[model samples]
Target: MTKNISKEIPKEKRFLIMVILLTGVFFTLLNETLLNLAIPVLVNEMDAAPSTVQWVVTGYMLIMGVFIPVSSLMIQWFTTRQLFIGSLVLFSVGSLVSGLAAALPYLFIGRFFQAMGTALLLPLMMHTLLMLYPAKKRGTVMGFIGLVIMVAPAIGPPLSGVILDFLNWRWLFFMMLPLIFLVLISSIFVLDNVTTVTRPKIDIRSILFSIFGFGGIVFGLSFAGDESVSWLNPSVYISLCVGLVCLSGFVWRQLKSVTPMLEMRTFRHPMFSLAALLLFIGMMTQFSTIILLPFLFENALGVSTVAAGLILLPGAIINGAISPFIGRIFDKFGPKILVIPGMILLVIGLQLFIKVNTATSILMFILLYTLVMIAIAMIIMPAQTNGLNQLPAKYYSHGTAIFNTLQQIAGATGIAFYVTMMSVGQNLYPSTSGIIGGAGRYSRCRDTVCF
Candidate 1:
């Protein structure tokens, strides 16, 4: 809506806008975990490095970290409808490019486009949601949105798993095209601009720093596990150094700027800082497990792709089923009550993940994964709400933005770390125990064999 419109939008209009935005959100989130089961298949089908194959996931999120800061800029420079169409177009093109890709580099290019679409859609949805809901009702409203939002990712593995069983990995991206087309048509006809351009101050330096900083770090993490590369490879260390130096510059610039891209001061609130830390850790856990389990079941234990997806399904379902209720529980009791127990459960769950081996039962892994998801559901929103509560009204806008940006970065780092560790362990013991999965993964003769 232009600034020319009424303060309160009509209910029918609000519902249409929300439905369109949520559809976009669902598509973006679904792609996030959909490819976990596809990684091994891509490695075999494309003759790509397993480590590099991970870029399909990390590259997407890295682009997200870069653009999330710029989302505000996008809103100011364009109308809500303009931004919405732009994001959808980016996603559509990305899906098409990725589906047609014949090599790893081409796939990366497609993922980059998709990530940009996703980065923009997230903040836009939040902006529309905030405008539509009143203050007191937003908590419950967000709770319900959280319910729907969380389910998309939860179901991704199973959905993709079914696809992988019958089709090529390209179908993962191909399947989304029809849905994207439908959303584009509906949005063009039904969705209207919600807000006009506000033309905020631009910070070129801040954007540059974030790009180089997060980019360097994720690049470093992605390579750290490649058995072909030395631990001392410049691609690993130099990129890391550049990322760190650039990120330091980004932080300094944010602190010095009068109109920072992200508000650094919100962190001064003790609760906000604490909650950010907790959420960061939680995000790391969620991402690492999502990648690791599929690798374990499919690659290590020799489980079928459909079977692996089915194994992860229970955890996904349990996580989605309980989320909205968890929000209600938080509303009634407050964060500490949930956060404390959630932390306990998360810790216990991670500990059990360590116990997983080729011999571990499918049922046992399901229980462990479900517990972790449940803990995460408990921690993420409630802690976020509590932390935002610590800030005054003025910081609310940037507060949420900063929080989301950090989560994307955290997820990238987590996936890179886990992928690297798996590579490292595979490299160190490829011959010692005659393990099946890791042995076959890096074997030069195209089959598992001892050195």
Candidate 2:
């Protein structure tokens, strides 16, 4: 969309700039789920229930949902250097807070800061990268980012697995502080202003609506996913209703505002809308697997945290390795070339997962998970690049923000739905089969299944 933009900037300088964004992205994305491996450990060490401890992961995502929409406005209001440096600093502070945390609530405080940092950085990277490269090259660059998205979590779990194996759970955050600081320092030399600052008027009411709107929805979804909470529970229905109501108000506020925080009209483009919907579905399924596999391995299949963490490594690595090439293909071809087969591949993988059980071989699990991950790598970035390509250049920031905002919410929603579905199903049967038994119930409970 940035047709005839500044290719005048030295290619090497651009490369350095991209490296900074990617490294930050890798760290943020890693922290997003690095704790999956640490969950069991945190549960025991922190003296928290499994459900409560899980929020460390879910809260990070939900918080991202709250802030990402505002990033589009921030992109216009601040210099790229200011946003990047500030976000990394906040994330570092969060990591230090988390590493020093002595209690679960303290971890939430730290994670809040961490999530805020990530929420800003993720969209900023995409928006900045788009400003750096034109449409012709986006596929390959976004593909590289796909490598980070696919590989960071792949690496995070096993890496954290080893850390948890040898060190305290707090080391997870402590380990990230150095990486954050390195990126922070690197950004000082390379980060520059890319977009023009309009210094748009801040809509105070819309901000509140977004906070409560997205927050309420994430909260309701979290509650809905808990097996212990009945559908009729006041917490469940009331939260969901309030969330819906606030979200509706938020949408109205956006549509009515001339200078909306998030320009709701980006959906006017059919391709962007379609792309957003598909991206949401893809992230949900991918995250569901990302979160669930560790649970199945360590809890259901009786694997070690280390082994559970390592299980997903191979396929994800392969996906990371090939993603760039896949991007090249997208550059030459187009979205349908990737999206069609990727969707079919994903559906097939999900079908196979339905039959998975405690006895399923680790290699088999890896193979199936790889199928899903590759499908995701194929679909996620290319589809997003393709969708953004369709939009007017002015809407690029809003499009990136929307893409990221939906992505975070989708991760939270997907995790909540699938996790609760499995728990609900497993509790119904009360078997040693764990997620497999849940899958079985899911198959029969057609109206309420996620397998």
Candidate 3:
């Protein structure tokens, strides 16, 4: 019989494993948003067409959607060590390929590989935490993990900006090479492999459904910023309808399956559902804000790449610093105490953002933004812990995936929803302002502006 390492996980081993897991999580979180800031750099340096180069971003998102739903199966199918090392290898290889690529398509292909590995890293780490730690300790450990995951993306842009300012955009991929080796070594020593019986059959149909449905949804939302498509257009409406139907079908199928890709029943628990809802809301604002920052910094704010990162650094730093404390507090108190305050801070941050114009100061922006980041970090752990806390130990592997999948969907949806709302606001606000410019017509259309 294999010796159970449950009671014997050394402190050094635990710390090493966490470092390994965080390394993977860091790259995963960093890769998604890092490239947003690098797009202009890539376009200029590589001389790539905009439509074609966009695949780098879109392809990564699509692969993330494709691979995410399968993460739960991977946890059960492969040993923790197997999954951890395998994913790291894939990501490392992808980064190397992208770093060395001579052409755009190859770079995108490399990004797809990177996305494949990244999609599994976070959920798998959460599963590992649950498996490795005792019940009481799991929350604390996960809180720290949550903090790492949250801060990495928040800081990714500024870090990437510094890299791009000093070196070529390829350095973004090259930098990962050394970190990848460090993480690989850590995985070999830190990760534990134990056999479990619950290797549920992979539901290929549900997997395809999730991929197509989510992909369609994201693709449609990606166009929200420009005057690209009208909602009244037949093609737009059809795609939206089909995407909604496919997602509904995926949910319906999950409810009936013996081994569902997502366990809908878990959401039946009130606290779990509420946490999931709040997570959705938080991710919506946080992710959208990250996406918007690069555009704002570059265009409206006129901040240089290195300068923007320097400006953004404090938010990420404060966010990371506050997470462990939030975790400890959540363990002592319930999630509500942290979640409520964190959300209020988030709203304050968002409200402050509305005041940002072409002449805004970086110092003033960062001050408000830091509060948003801290608030988000505060809520993330408690919310994630609260979600996982509702389920039993056996479901930990699957449950973590479900939590992350919810986060992914929420983040994606938040981006889509915010873009759409902004588009609507832009269209309506200008037209209304024009009508108001004409006093005679303005009186007739007064209800339009008020409404």
- Name the candidate that leads on lDDT: 2
Number of the top-ranking candidate, with TM-score as the measure: 2
* Candidate 2 off by > 4 Å: 1-4, 43-45, 354-359, 432-450
Please list the residue runs of candidate 3 whose C-alpha ends up more than 4 Å from where it truly belongs after superposition: 1-8, 194-197, 225-239, 352-360, 428-451
Q: Residue-wise lDDT of candidate 3 within 128-233, one digit each (tens)?
A: 7766666566557876787777777767777787777789888888988888888888778767674364678888888877777766665555444223446566
What lDDT tens digits, residue by residue, belong to model 2 across residues 1-451?
2454548677888888889999999999899878977888889889999989988987887788889888998988988899999999889999999999999999999999999999999989998888888788999998988888788877877788778778998889998988888889888987877876789999888888888888777777777666676667787678778878888998899999888888889898888888998999998887777667766665555677778767878888988988899889999998899999999998888788767655667889889878888898888888899999888777888999999888777876886787677667565656536675654543433222226
Q: Candidate 1: minimum summed lDDT over ten consecutive residues — where?
A: 442-451
**Candidate 3 clash pair list:** 158-309
lDDT of 3: 0.71
What lDDT score is found at residue 13 in candidate 2? 86
Instruction: List model 1 lDDT by residue over 220-331, tens digit each.
Output: 7656634466548988889889989998998899899887777788889999999899889888877767666666666656787677778877887787778768877766
What value does the lDDT take at residue 266 in candidate 1?
87
Give all candidates' CA lDDT scores: 0.75, 0.82, 0.71
Each prediction's TM-score against the native?
0.84, 0.92, 0.87
Worst 10 residues of 3 by lDDT: 442-451
How much does each candidate deviate from the true structure in C-alpha RMSD?
5.1, 3.0, 5.0
